[model samples]
Target: MVPPAVESPNPQLTQQFLSSALSQRGPSALPYSEDTKWLIRHHLLSLTTSFPSLEPKTATFTHNDGRSVNLLQSDGTVPMPYQGVTYNIPVVIWLMESYPRHPPCVYVNPTRDMVIKRPHSHVNPSGLVSLPYLHNWIYPSSNLVDLVRALSLTFAADPPLFSQRRAPRTPPSHNPNPNPSPNFDSFSSGSSNPGAFSSGYSRPSIPPNNYPPSPYASGSGRVQPSPTTTTSHHGEDQSEVFKRNAINKLVEIVHGDVVGLRKTREGEMEGLFSVQGVLKQREDQLNKGLKGMRDEMEGLEQQLQMVLMNSDVIEGWLRDNQGKKFRSLENVEDAFECVDVLSKQMLDCTASDLAIEDTLYALDKAVQVGSVPFDQYLRSVRALSREQFFHRAMVAKVRAAQLQAQVANMASRNQHYAV
Candidate 1:
């Protein structure tokens, strides 16, 4: 029969499958648990250790230009002293091959760019810290963990780059040339455009007519129209005065518009607040239900995780417990077997004891019959007693050997908990 031809995979389908796989994989699922070489694996964090909040992208050990220098990525919490208050700071320590012999290099991993360099006390231009402990590091005595702790203390005396970047202090109160308001008197500078120098309200221009004394006067209310008034003599009519007064009146309209806007906003806000109370009550009811369900779901998820984690510990405990019980039972069974064997050995001893009893009975019967001589009977009795005594000694030695063998076997098998 002819072999069937194999169908070739469609390139489009292959690409689609790959894309779906990548999407579902989702950034390695647990980045820290990937396969690594033995050298790198040895330095990786244990189950007991807390992982760094900001770990390097790759956990691989870096080699320095093919030299013996190997840099291991380590990150964890370090105790920090910040202004009389102690805080835990995260740091990265690089371990080299000549580890205990040489102090590991350390850096503050605050997770953002900061003023890394000097006049910055402990920290060097390269971002490497120079703590007193690091400078005089004794090969075997000085460790990386303590060195990082010292760097944290150093930061308090010299605040970090970000700490110095606080909001600019409330603007200085002193101003040599205090501008009370825009000088509308100078039209060229102030009235070039309405928007110029307009911070909320514009300064009103000074009126040329300082005539009638009014109740709202800031300074001398009426300056009797200058003795040398020119308007009348220059053929300027009352229309000119009327026009100037009207222009001044426009400034009052600006103030009126501002007041109207403020009132409209306040009224609108009051209406919304009256309606907001009703909506807030309804929102609380719905939110309570939604939040309760969400919390229940989260609680269930956490409970399941806890149970699964406990299962491994439980299994280990059960296995060790079962093993100990089995060993104990085996020892008991062996003891029973040994006792049975010793009992069987003692069968000979029982026979010897019975023989002694029989010899006495025979001696009693002889004395009653007066058939056998008293001397002969006494000689037989002595020989029988001697034989019985010999057998008892031999049996005792054999019984001891049997017990010793059983004890040795148990001790060998249960080496750790042997009695």
Candidate 2:
């Protein structure tokens, strides 16, 4: 097609284009509004000057394993190995463009064969992969070099291992159960190194002459000398004797203070222990008393149950003994009728006895009236008969005699006449 031939990419132009592209994003990128030519020039200057100057050099760092590791920032990525762990390395600088404004990206590029248990881990708990001490770059209008240097030092120190490790927070106290576990923090032995022992550094040692008097010795107004005394052999070199005497007095005073402190502590501990023991004894007694009361209540309840059962039994027996038979009206009527019949029979017997007595009395009265004047009555009858008979005889005799007498009288008359 006889078209114009395409020109090859210019080294400068290619570099410029790549720089412009790289500088468009990120905090360390060049100004976004800059002209292409200026952008190219800016990127060119950064490549030729800034990048080589900024990168950390190869330095030997000692690891926890007693092994020395060579560290450096290289093209692509440099894998930092620590404690059988590998961390992805970040680019130190980009040659094409982006100045201080565009910090480079990092990747995990392992040159040596390694095992990564997890990816995208972090030193801080937030899991943010960050440049240490570079919080200022995160903000605007700050020195980026210092930030980079701090990041460099953090990397050199290999703080990921330690920063990831944290001491556990204090645990919550156990309650209700009241059996408190021992305080682990109080019992744990701390490392002896000053750096490890406390956040504050140890104070520098003072010389013997510079040492302050002991707090205990201060009350006695003197400082004690060491056993290795610095003095002449004289019993009393005035100054030396005075120093010794003052030291002895201070020692005595310190000893006395210690003795007092010990006594005070002992008394306080004894009082606490006694109070605890007394409270325990009172609690035990209260529990025992409650138990005794419960036992007594149970016993009383049992007795009450037995009494109720007995009452029920007795009631059942009484009901059975005094049952319907005894309560029947027919039986009661029969008993009353029997009593009336017996009363009537007794009355009849009494009437019969009274009638017998009257009959006997009548019989006795008839017998008394019918009884005779026996002999007098008999004599009267006999005499009446005899008197009649005798009267007849006398009449006859008189008649006879009269007849005779008449005869005689006649005779006698005759005789009398004769007389």
Candidate 3:
């Protein structure tokens, strides 16, 4: 099955545009790819949105020769000034089979007479408009809507009919030379002309291309177009595009500033958080130290309390028993007489006990050392002990008296307790 030759975005006008396109474009029109069809539909849709005067429809016309062709174009009316006069001009953008790879072609279809000459740099007598941007087109980066906007700006600068050519500059004449050397032609052979030798070589003539400076060229051969002629091929340049680029750059700068400010604030917050953490740690350590010190202080206080209690008890004991007196009965002289007798008896008893213990120890030692027989030594010790025992009994009676006198003296003094 043969695919439809024309794809109309606006289905209502499809039949009418099909007839028109068949008549205008040839029978050999190529079938559009899916992408090309989509771009055309999109271009038409955008034209309608931007230019209310657009008649968005696809058209094809079948000629009498039994041939059908498709014209891929979207027509619109745009307000423009020509020769200092404003008029809404009818325009059309045609998409070829090789679109996207090839730039879209434009035509300024005037409603008026065909013979009327319009002074436009890019729009010639045939109504073909050449755009510099289209000449420098790169697909995906360049869109139909942008192309339309560029058209708008191109019209805003000196539009087609208003831009006229200035007078052509005439070349300066260097024809008549009064002092012509006849032998100048002979200068081709350096040694042939004597007159050519007398006169130095004549200055070289300047080329016509160099004499008349091309509008695009300066002293340097670089093609530098004026700002007004940036789109001279399309009769005007796009100042709006430059302005838009500048605005976008400014927005980027502001965004960068905002990002920098956020980073600075985050850094400051981080610093503050670190400081707070350090301070909290220090506080915890100080509190722990304070708790330990308080515990130590409490222990010291308890020790002091115990010491004070002990001291108080000692002081009370001293206060109660430091000085005291005892009341006793009579018979003091008798007690003194008894004490002297008893003391003399105690001294005699102690001496007898010592002599008995010494004799026993000496006899035991002599027997142990083999100086005497064990039986003889024992008999000698027994005799001495019996004599000592008699003396000890007498001494015991004297000691009992002496103890009684000591008790009397202690009662009189009364050092620790009251009597």
Which has the greatest lDDT?
A: 3
For model 3, the local distance difference test gives 0.55
lDDT of 1 by residue, 1-419 (tens): 11122233344553443333223345432222122222123223220021222132224444557633223445544433333333344456765445544555666654321223235666556556567786687633344434543555565455432211111222336645445334332232324343332332222233423211221122332212212211111243578546534543653465467669989999999999989998999999999999999999999986675566457657876686573445556465453332365666766676676778787788879877997788888887788879877877867887677556655754675796665
lDDT of 3 by residue, 189-282 (tens): 3333435534534322445222212211123343322222122224323684566455446655665686799899999999999999999999
Candidate 1: C-alpha RMSD after superposition: 36.9
Residue 59 in candidate 2, Cα distance off native in Å = 30
The most accurate candidate by TM-score is 3
Ranking by lDDT: 3, 1, 2
Task: Tally clashing residue pairs in candidate 3.
Answer: 9
Q: How much is 163 displaced in model 1, in angstroms?
A: 3.4
Q: Which should have the higher lDDT, number 1 or number 2?
A: 1
User: TM-score: which is higher, 1 or 2?
Assistant: 1
Which regions in candidate 3 have their CA more than 4 angstroms from the true location?
A: 1-30, 60-68, 81-86, 113-119, 162-419
Global lDDT of each model? 0.47, 0.40, 0.55
Error of 3 at 347 (Å): 99
Per-residue lDDT of candidate 2, residues 276-330 (tens digit): 9999999999999999999999999866855665577578767865634655565
Model 2 regions lying over 4 Å from their true place: 1-128, 138-148, 159-419
Off by over 4 Å in 1: 1-70, 88-90, 164-419
